[model samples]
Target: MLGLFIAQVLNGLLDGTYYLLIALGLSLIFSLGGIINLAHGAFFAIGAYLALLITPYVGYFGALVAVPLIVAGLGMVTERTLFTRFYRIDPLYSLLLTFGIAMVIEQGLRWVFGASPQSYNIPDILRGQVFLGDFIYSRYRIFLIAVAAVAVAGLWLLLNRTSFGRIVRAGVQSPEIVGALGISLRPYLSIVAGIGIGLAGLAGVLLSPIYTIHPAMGAEIITLAFVVVVIGGLGSFWGVIIAAVLVGLTKGVLVAIGLSSWSTAAIFLLMFVVLLLRPRGLLGERILRFE
Candidate 1:
């Protein structure tokens, strides 16, 4: 029983990685663009569908590499065509826009692929279990953790270490100052959107094998992803990471205690506690635009 409890805790942590991937992108896009992208999950679904379509020709590894880039390109296009128009306007406009896009993508997928769920097999190379003492875990999940960690670390370095990141951070604080410095945030905005949305695509690819792939899969996950972002605070990168872990831990503990049916409710309860304590989120920093 103790072993099972420990295993459930670990499983919960693994579950957090999925939210981490999706929520990071949600946070980044909102931080930089001021766009509350409701359609981000649709992109995630697209990635999974794209993986299914391409994996046959390029294989799983190939799909993993190619799908994100393709989705990122699509994100860049969306930023240029749709997001750019609403940057200086009311945020609600962008929200509505993204919601419509989400619906379109969902229905488009349904039209093309039907409403049925699709299945993806685990790659042959990653198929197995690893036993650690009395606990056993999926090898693919281990690989998923490693990939998510690397992606997070790389993103951190890019934001904290690079000149591009410096500008983005400054822009987040004060777009007026960035504009005064004669830096057109246009290119940066496009790139950020691509990077953020691309991460969603990557999550879709990595999770497709384990999750049921369907048109509404994106919709199903987006709410939890939003919960993570809200609990973490809107623009705080580290907050999102911590929140994801906490959310996962909360769910894990609930399951371990034999309240598995209440796991989802427990996460919301955890968020309520966090918000009651810290309205701005655990580490949410004040930004000019949001204020």
Candidate 2:
């Protein structure tokens, strides 16, 4: 039982890692651009499809590198062609535009790949089961944990330690102020969009082997990601990371103890409770109108 519990906890953390990557990117872009980015998930699907094309040729490790690059390029294009034009509009316009793009992307994927889930296998070296206390865990899950850790660390450094990160942080607080500083923010905005969608792509590649890779695979996760962002406090990047992992762990604990029904509602309930007591979310402040 002890070993089993440890293994389950590990699984939960591994799961949370993917959630963190996806939510972290989403939160950052939303903060900097004030765009809800509903099409972020479409980038995930694009990554999966890119991985599918390359995995057979370069294998899993190479697929990881190639998929993100391809999807990142696509994300850049999307930002320039679609998202950028909506920048001056209200936040609702951004939200609606992205949501519509997501619908189009999904339909395209369904048309090409059909409605069935596609199967992907982890590399041979990373395959098979490893034993811990006579309980076996898949090596792929362990790989996921490692990959997630590195990705999150890289993102942390990008957003907090680097000059680009400093610029991003400044823009997040106030885009116009950053713009007036004699810096062309359009380039930065495009780069941030690429990073955000690239992370989503990475999540798709990470989850491909574990979950059914279908046209609509991103929908459920997108909903959960939103809950995490809201509960973590929108416009706060690290808060999203912390809250996502906690929610992932909560789901694991709830389901492990036979409260499976609560697993679906767990984060939502937490959000509701948090908002009731703290309207600004866990890390946000209520925006007040000027007198």
Candidate 3:
């Protein structure tokens, strides 16, 4: 029983990786561009479908590399064509636009792939279990955790240690000042959108083996991703990380305690309590545009 409990806790912590991937992108796009991208999940779904298509020829490893780039390119295009118009305006407009975008992508996927759920087998190389003492875990999940960690760490370094990141951070706080300095944020916006949407794509690819691949999969996961972002505080990078862990921990504990049915509800309860205590989120910063 004790080993089971420990295994569940570890599993829960690793599960946070998925939320971290999706929420980071969601937070980044909203923080910099002020666009609440409802279609973000659609990109995730697209990634999974793309993987299904490309993996046959290029193999899983190849699809893993190519899918995110493809989705990111699509994201850049969407930002240039659609998202650019809605910046600096009422967020409602962008929200509605993204919602429409989401619907269109979902339907387009349905039209192309049909409404059926698809399956992608785990690559044979990663198909196995890792036993640590009495606790056993999926090898693929361990790999997933490692990939997520690297992605998150790399993103942190990019945002904190690079010139591009500095400009983005500044723009998020004061677009007017960034513009005053003659720094055109247009290219940055497109790139950020790509990076953000691309993260979602990567998540899609990683999870495709384990998750049920269907048109509604993106829609199903987006809400939980939003919860992570909200709990972590909008625009707070570290906050999102912590919140994902907490959310996963909460669910894991519930399951471990034989109250699995309440796991989902407990996550909401955790969010409600956090909001009651800190309205701006765990680490949300004061952005002039949001203020």
Candidate 4:
């Protein structure tokens, strides 16, 4: 039982990475753009589908590098063409617009990819299981964990240690100040949109082999990602990270105890409790008002 518990916990941690990546993007976009993006999941689905189409030509390694770029570019275009116009308008308009886009993308993918789930071939090198102490886990899962950690670490360094990151952080706080300083917030905000959407794409690519790749795959995870964002605090970077791990572990523990069906309910319950206890979220700082 102890070994099983440990194994499940590890599995939960692996699952947390997906939540982290998705929420990271959601949080970043909201922080920088003041636009609540409901179509973020569509970007994820697009990434997975793109990977499916491109992987044969480029192979898994090449697809990994190309898919995010493709999705990020798409996101940038969407921002430039659609989202940017809605920024100073009501947040509801942005939300409704993105929601519509998500539906359109989802239905389009369904028409193209069909209603069924597609199988993603796990690379031969990552197919086996490895023993970690007394518990054995899939090597692919461990690789996913490593990739998520690295991605999160890289993002942290980018936001904390670099000039662009500083601009992002400052812009998140006050775009007016950033503009007054002579830096056009447009490029930085666009980049944030790309990074945010790209992170979702990256998550889609990483989890494709493990989960059933389908047109509605983004819908499956987006709610949980939003829950992570709310529980972690809307624009709080570290808050999202902590909430992702917490929610993932909670679900893992329930599943390990033979309550898999209750996992989602449990997470929602936890979110409710957290909101009641700390409305701003675990690591959320003062909410920023975008001008």
Candidate 5:
């Protein structure tokens, strides 16, 4: 039972890491772009599909490094051509546009790759398991934890320790002020979109090995990602992290207790509770919009 408990906790922590990656990007995009990108999941699907196509040529590590850039470039293009138009309009327009984009991407991928799910094998190096006393865990999972931790730390540094990051955060708070200060926030907005989409791509790459790659995969996880965002608050960075961990751990514990069926529902329930108690989210700041 102790071993089982330990294993569940480990699994929960890893699941939280996945949520963190997805939610972080969602938070960044919504906070900075002021648009709820319903197509964010499409970027995720693109990353996994791109990995499947390129991994054979460049290897897993190469695909990991390359796919995010490719996706980011695509994100920048989409932002400039399509998303930028709706920023000044009602956010509803952008939301609808993104929803359409998501549908298009999903259908396009399905047409190209067919409806069957694809699988990728973990690299030989990351295979096998490690023992911690009597508990054993997959090395790949440990690598996931490491990768997620590093990504989070790097993001924190970028946001808190760097000038560019400061500008982006400031832009999030006041775009007009940023522009008035002789800084063109337009470029930063594009970069923020690219970075946000790139993070989603990264999540897809990491998840490809564990989950089956399918067009619908992104749709499946995207709602949960939104739940994480709402629980964490719309624009709160640390809030997403905390909510993700809490949801992940709670789901893991529920599954361990033989209530696997209720894991997702448990997440929704938690979100509802958070909403009732703290409507602004755990770490969310003042209401940004007049909804």
Candidate 6:
């Protein structure tokens, strides 16, 4: 039982890593850009598909490098043509617009790729297991955990150490004050949207070897991602990290207890309980949005 619990904890923590990536990006968009982007899942799905499509031609590493750039470009275009229009409108308007975009991307993928679950072969380099005392662990899974850790740490440095990150952090607090200093927000807004959606795309690409890729894959994860984002609070990246691990732990423990069906319900319950008690989330500031 102890071994099983330890294994479940490992699984849960790794699962939380990807959830962290998705929620981190979502929090940035919500807090700074003020876009409740339902289309985030689409970008994630696209990243996966693009990786699959490119793998045959470019190999896995190439796909990882190339697909994110392509996804970032797509995100930038999305911001310019669609998200920009909703900037001055009510926040709900942007959410609805992104939701429409999500639906359209889903259908488009279905039309182009069909509704099949596409498989990705794991590279031979990461396919084995490491035996530790009485337990064995998959190398690929450990690699994923390490990668997720590096991703989060890198993003933290990006947002907290660099000038670009500093501006973004300040903008999250209040864009108005930043804009008053003569920095035109239009370009920065596009960059931020690109990064948010790009991170989703990156998440998708990394998930290619871990899960079957399909049109409905994004739909499956988005709800969970939203729960983590809300649980972690809207504006705080650290909150996203904590919330993601919590959700992952909940699902893992519930599955171990033989109630696999309750995974989604578990998240809903956790979010509800957290909100009921904390109201502003673990680290989320109360009423960050002035409107």
RMSD values for the candidates in order, in angstroms, are 0.9, 2.3, 0.8, 1.4, 1.3, 1.5
Q: 88-124 in candidate 5: lDDT tens per residue?
A: 8888899899999999999999999999999798989
Give the TM-score (vs. native) of candidate 4.
0.97
Q: Which stretches of candidate 4 lie over 4 Å from their true place?
A: none
User: RMSD (Cα, Å) of candidate 5?
Assistant: 1.3
Give stretches of model 5 more than 4 Å off: 287-291
User: CA lDDT, every prediction?
Assistant: 0.93, 0.80, 0.94, 0.90, 0.89, 0.85
Candidate 1 lDDT over residue span 250-282, tens digit each: 898898998889999988988899889998888
Instruction: Please give each candidate's TM-score.
Output: 0.98, 0.92, 0.99, 0.97, 0.96, 0.95
lDDT of 2 by residue, 126-167 (tens): 888878766677888888878878888898898889999999
Candidate 3 lands at a TM-score of 0.99
Error (Å) of candidate 2 at residue 203 is: 1.0
Clashing pairs in 3: none
lDDT at 104 for candidate 3?
98
Query: Can you tell me which runs of candidate 1 are displaced by over 4 Å?
Result: none
For model 4, how does the per-residue alpha-carbon lDDT over 1-291 read when each residue is reduced to its tens digit? 888998899878767878899899999999888888889998999999999999999999898889999999999999999989998988999999999999999999999989999989889988999987888888998888888899899999999999999999888888889899999999888999999999989988888998888989888989999999989998898899989999989999999999999999999999999989988888777755842
**Candidate 4: lDDT over CA atoms?**
0.90
Off by over 4 Å in 3: none
Error of 3 at 24 (Å): 0.2
Arranged by lDDT with the best first, the candidates are: 3, 1, 4, 5, 6, 2
Instruction: Give the lowest summed-lDDT range of ten residues in model 1.
Output: 282-291
Q: Quick one: best lDDT, which candidate? A: 3
Q: Residue 86 CA error for candidate 1 (Å)?
A: 0.7
lDDT of 2 at 26: 84
RMSD of 1: 0.9
Candidate 2: misplaced stretches above 4 Å? 1-7, 134-136, 285-291
